[model samples]
Target: MRSPTLARRERHDLCDLALVLGEDAPTLCGEWTAKELVAHLLVREHSPLGALGIAVETFARLTDRAMARLGRRDFAVLVEQLREPGLTPYALWPVEVLGNTLEYLVHHEDLRRAQTDWQPRENTPADDDAIWTAIRIGGRALVRPAGVPVRIRRADTGKEVTLRGGAEPVTIIGSPTEVTLFLFGRRQLHDVTFEGPTEKVAALRRAALGF
Candidate 1:
């Protein structure tokens, strides 16, 4: 039977890459090094206290403390911890697929794209389809905060999402991965084309596009 664990596989590969890149390598996640990024992943998955900090402003300090503490641990050990199965609430099947597929994929690219010699990975069609599904399910919220009429189109498959409640929407066209990155507020780094009214497109480009 075919496996239903593609996201888990991606997470494993990301963890392995983190271990290889060492602790001080730059990542697309602001000033976070690979170590910080790995710490974030560990806290995100393993600690409810840390995870709460992600959504609750009041918990921000606790989250930072948790990450800092975790970041001090040996790097390879942390990566191994990330590879451990069923260690967090997010480890369940549908949740793993829904929550982590895009999370890990985006963060994986965050590491790669931050490198000067980076190139986009050749994702399988299955991977694209999975990301597209994520965009269709959760992308609207990411775009809605920008308060603009925006449409996202996948160049490879012609799939599109219209995220506006008004006319004269801005349409962004790219591969599924690129569109996902754009929606996630990585617009400056994503390779995409915008087609719409010049003013609207320009505004959309300048507007903060993600959650």
Candidate 2:
């Protein structure tokens, strides 16, 4: 779950992402402008709490509009809108708070990858729990085919988890942020140190997304 403080911090981090995108700058998500990112977030903030399909449709409409008229100045306004209390639930996830945390941290990294000084500082324990849950939910299996085993360790908490079976054992060690990105198809394996058999990692990389 997200603490109130962490939720607020993530909101701010997302707002900063929009602010830095400049008036017409494009984002890493397709051709979405930073303003479009803000618009999408705002729409998500206001989306229905029930019915996932309904939420998806609503988000698509909002994204379409945002893409047509996104601008830096508009993004600035959206940032201010986010600063207000109770703008929406502000809870990052619908199923589990940990899921939300993982989403925020990973997306924050996505935005930061494009900026020189956009790093968002995360509270260690929350991020740790989020990463652990993300892996257990079968996120690690996303890179490879079924039946690949993966051993992951959280550097901050020194907690080690192993997802085993189906081919070979693949080992990965690093911060939660690093592991999350790797599972989500963002960061490269080179940024992460891999041990165990090469075939294991290769097979794991070819597996489908578990969760």
Q: Rate the local accuracy (lDDT) of all candidates.
A: 0.82, 0.57
Give the least accurate 10-residue stretch of model 1, judged by summed lDDT.
183-192
TM-score (C-alpha) between model 1 and the true structure: 0.93
Per-residue lDDT tens digits for candidate 2, residues 75-117, read 5677677553354454433533443555555555656665554
TM per prediction: 0.93, 0.67
Mind sharing the TM-score for model 2? 0.67
27-138, model 1: which lDDT tens digit per residue?
9888999999989888888788888998798898888999989977899888888885565667688888888888888888888888788877778898888888888787
Model 1: per-residue Cα lDDT at residue 175 = 91
Q: In the order shown, what is each candidate's alpha-carbon RMSD?
A: 1.6, 4.9
In candidate 2, where is summed lDDT lowest over 10 consecutive residues? 46-55
Candidate 1, residue 165: how far the Cα is off, in Å = 2.8
Scored by lDDT, model 1 comes in at 0.82
